[model samples]
Target: MEQQTQDKSTMVVFSGDLDKAMASFIIATGAAAMGKQVTMFFTFWGLNILRKEEYVNVKKTFMDKMFAKMMPQGPEKLGISKMNYGGLGAKMMKYTMKKKNIVTLKELIEMAQDLDVKMVACTMSMDVMGITKEELIDGLDYAGVASYLADADESKINLFI
Candidate 1:
């Protein structure tokens, strides 16, 4: 009798507003921390998270207003945590980091890369948003729908964020 091996994979697809993007990446980072092979596919609004300038300018869109009225507008307004207040929130983050030795989001990204998490940028969305390849961070892998599909096909855990 031949034994079949099970493949463990997690596909995190980002397609929502700023909060969603932040949440998805944080989860992906957590998954990597757990020794799992993680692949993050950024598409549509999710891809905006990869835009260097937009990372700090993420905003709530029309649809966001309809449903997430209570949510903050843009990454800057979005609290560093789900439980923190406004500007005081950001201040608290710096204080806590100094107290507990935590890393910033940019540092987390670098750590994620060091952990071998694959970050794929959707080429279709990039073209639609007029974002050139050079506009993205270096080493970001650009792929088409077929590539994402292939990833989904191989992934045992596929998520559309």
Candidate 2:
């Protein structure tokens, strides 16, 4: 872990779509299992994936409240990028994945956490969206682009999803 070298994998998650978030977690867990140092930086809409599934009692401005109300709480509420059809597509996709025994996004997130894959939430994005750290899940690092860049610079692989 001390060595910042080629065995590192980094991804900037800028999409909140269920498919994109799942893909990011899948890659992160897979890379971690392969013994790579993985870091997933979530920004903008992607931050929604880290939000608490239950409503958090955090004080916010009117605009912030609006954003919170509109944004998805967690992986379960995320919509697919295409064919969402008012979230029906996401529901269908989750059902099919479960039927096929494919690991769901929530499971992938747990795997990533268990594997020690770093999950970073962009503080700047959170501020803009009126999201508080308390509103997100636990065991996450709050940072800015500089921190993400540092990880990316040391990583052999970097992706923006």
Q: Pick the candidate with the highest TM-score.
A: 2
- Model 2, span 103-124: residue lDDT tens: 9999899899999999999999
Q: Candidate 2 has what TM-score?
A: 0.97
lDDT of each residue in 1-161, candidate 1, tens digit only: 01111233455455544345555767778877877677787766565455554433234455533433343333334344354555575667656765897665556667778878888988887666555565466668989889877766766667787
**What residue pairs clash in candidate 2, if any at all?**
none
Global Cα lDDT for candidate 2: 0.93
Per-residue lDDT for 69 in model 1?
Answer: 37
**Where does candidate 1 stray beyond 4 Å?**
1-12, 16-18, 54-103
lDDT of each: 0.61, 0.93
Q: What is the C-alpha RMSD of each candidate to the true structure, in Å?
A: 6.6, 1.7
